[model samples]
Target: MSRKTLIPIGPYHPLQEEPELFKLYCDGEIVTDIKWETGYNHRGIEKLSESKSYDQVFFLVERICGICSTSHPFAFANAVEEIVAVEITDRAKYIRSIIGELERIHSHLLWVGLAGHFLGYNTVFMWAWKYREPVLDLFEMITGNRNSYAMFKVGGVRRDIENSKIPAIRKEIAVIRKKIDLLTGAVMDDPVIHARTKGVGILTRQDIIDYGAVGPTARASGVDIDVRRDDPYAAYPLVNWKVITAQAGDVFAKAEVRLLEMYESASIIEQCIDALEKMKEGDITLKINEIPEGLGTGRAEAPRGEVFHFVVSDGSNSPARHKIRAPSYTNIATFKKSCIGQTIADATLSLAAVDPCYCCTERMAAAYDNSSGKKILNANELIALSLKRTSELRKSGTGHE
Candidate 1:
């Protein structure tokens, strides 16, 4: 008897931190097809950016993803800076890179803890999250907020990493490096973990390329694309750090890439810290009177992958148009490639392997009149609605007029 069943894990599942629906069509234990839904978390952030000043847009974009908060601001700053044609101080460069790398370490640790919990390995979860606290503490010490550091701005950073603080930061980094070593060893060497993740949900290099996956998802499949190295930005070009990759493209391979990348991130942070030690602080931001009419594209490699921001300036305080493409936008699409043919039990882990950020991946696709149950807004209509709302806010003296 060929019996098929549909199993759904989402829209409000416990496995995911946010609401995303993943539908699995399975025959017995093997998943035959998979489909996922978004739009449940859309907030129209790009449209909102047009109403805020260039300086304020950094804060707006930073909330795109809590884990990749700084990542968005870093890219946004790069975009606006491109429009302004301004160069930030070298000291600011090092501080920016240090903050970026620290966020990478903390974000990877968060993913590792969540991955452990998903696999029913509570001890690994405990160890991973416990060590992650120190990294968050480092963020608090430097930027005051553990998640959304708000350290970025156009042309430069908001805060300078003082030379006096480098020693303490290095001490914390050393402790974190030791903890990472232990966690990496345990995960890499555990026979149970190997059995659960090694061959499960394997994605070939072609799959990664076809899906246009980024970050660890693509790197795990042997794709050597990194914005930090390929499209050099901020202090990444000044620092020496190699991209970490794995050949398997499986769940274990993804884990391997993230773990090894943490080491690379730490190394990059140390080098940046050393550079910061030789420079004097206080040259953090560059004053820009205005952003001239131009279009600029910026790319930053977040903990998951490349975060791209495009800004169009119309010689105004606010952006004429703002567009964002987070790494998860493409990475989430890979669930179709990795989850199909996977066992139902392995499908969720495969989905989680990419560390998809639902909030970062959503956009308002369509709108309807709920009362009439009829489509009322298409893409153009949605844009008009956005513009209209911005105009209303401006008229009310709430937006940058």
Candidate 2:
């Protein structure tokens, strides 16, 4: 008789930096079943948002995720703008689009680098990250911060792009586009990447709809739903762009979708620059006379997927209730289904296929101390411990073995 083996891959694993556990039920090298557990980094940002005023929440929302900070505030502000009926200027809309696409560029580059690092392709990782530096530099040139731009206000953007900066932005766009094309071609042509990614973990179209997946995850599965197209906000409706889709429903498909989308993002930025060049200068923001009691919902396509923000007001300065529906929240649910019946080595790539963003959409479950017979640590504590251990192992050269 054969024995059943249970291999725990996380709560601390090299493949995932986040504090989530994957118990792989396997026979030899082949995985038979998989179970996931996540409660390691829940900060309750949504609950905390209810306590903050509209103006204050903008800053709070930025902390939801470092990578998608711009999109969080954009979504939150869009909700508030809808309720207040704020009329943003055309220039502000173009600025918003430019900032958003810049963020997408940095984010996709970051993911590509991380994915490469996960697969032991250190050279690819280094090359991808080298390309990402310029995007971050361009962001700092405009927003004054590399990560949390804090450029979006409830009514409109905080500042307008200076006339002199237009030429620099165009030059940066042209340079970055050429570089991205070169790197994306390299990624597609790499045989090792193709072997590890293609047909590894697949999500069918029906599975995407049933699981409420969004962003590239759903698009990879042939579910053509992008908030930019389904519910256009800011200048998306005014722009000329098409949603990128893949029918393969596998990890390679997701990677292709993002790579192609980056090209589209560059084109979008070019369009925004052109639009900004022609717009007449005026006020970037509208005066908020007062707040009326109402509820508003805003949805935007973040780099990972659709980000949703709901705000309820009681005619006061602060919000009555605030809820955030991060794209990762929906996308993470399909992991178990996609990961089952695959090799343990495929686990990391499969997880990366969804573009998991732990810091943005995570909620921690309480931890128990068996020795003390009590719950001793919170989710954040567990996450910190997990990250600490992972870092220590990487430094000591004795972790994944």
Among the numbered candidates, top TM-score falls to 1
Tens-digit lDDT track of model 1 for 1-401: 88889898889987778998888999988998888778899898987888788878888999999999989998988888888888888988888899899999999999999989889888988999999999999999999988889898887888877788899999999999999999999999999899999988889999988989999999999999999999888899998889999999999999999999999999999999888888777888777777899999999999999999999999988999999999999998888888888887788888889999999999877767889989977999888887788789878997654
Q: In candidate 2, how many clashes are counted?
A: 4
Estimated TM-score for each candidate: 0.95, 0.89
Against the correct fold, how does model 1 do in TM-score?
0.95
Ten consecutive residues with minimal summed lDDT in candidate 2? 43-52
The Cα error of candidate 2 at residue 11, in Å, is 2.9
Q: Write the per-residue lDDT of candidate 2 for residues 1-401, one digit (tens) a residue.
A: 65769999778776677777778888877777777777676776776676567777888999988888888998998888888877688888889989999999888988888888878888878988899888888888888889898888877888778767889989998889988998899999999999999888899999899999999999999999999889888888888999999999998898899989999999999999888888766557777877788998988899999999898988988888888889998898888778877887787678777888877767656767879879888767875886787689889998543
- Cα displacement (angstroms), candidate 2, residue 169, comes to 0.7
* Candidate 1 weakest ten by summed lDDT: 392-401
Clashing pairs for model 1 are 11-20
Top-scoring candidate (lDDT) = 1
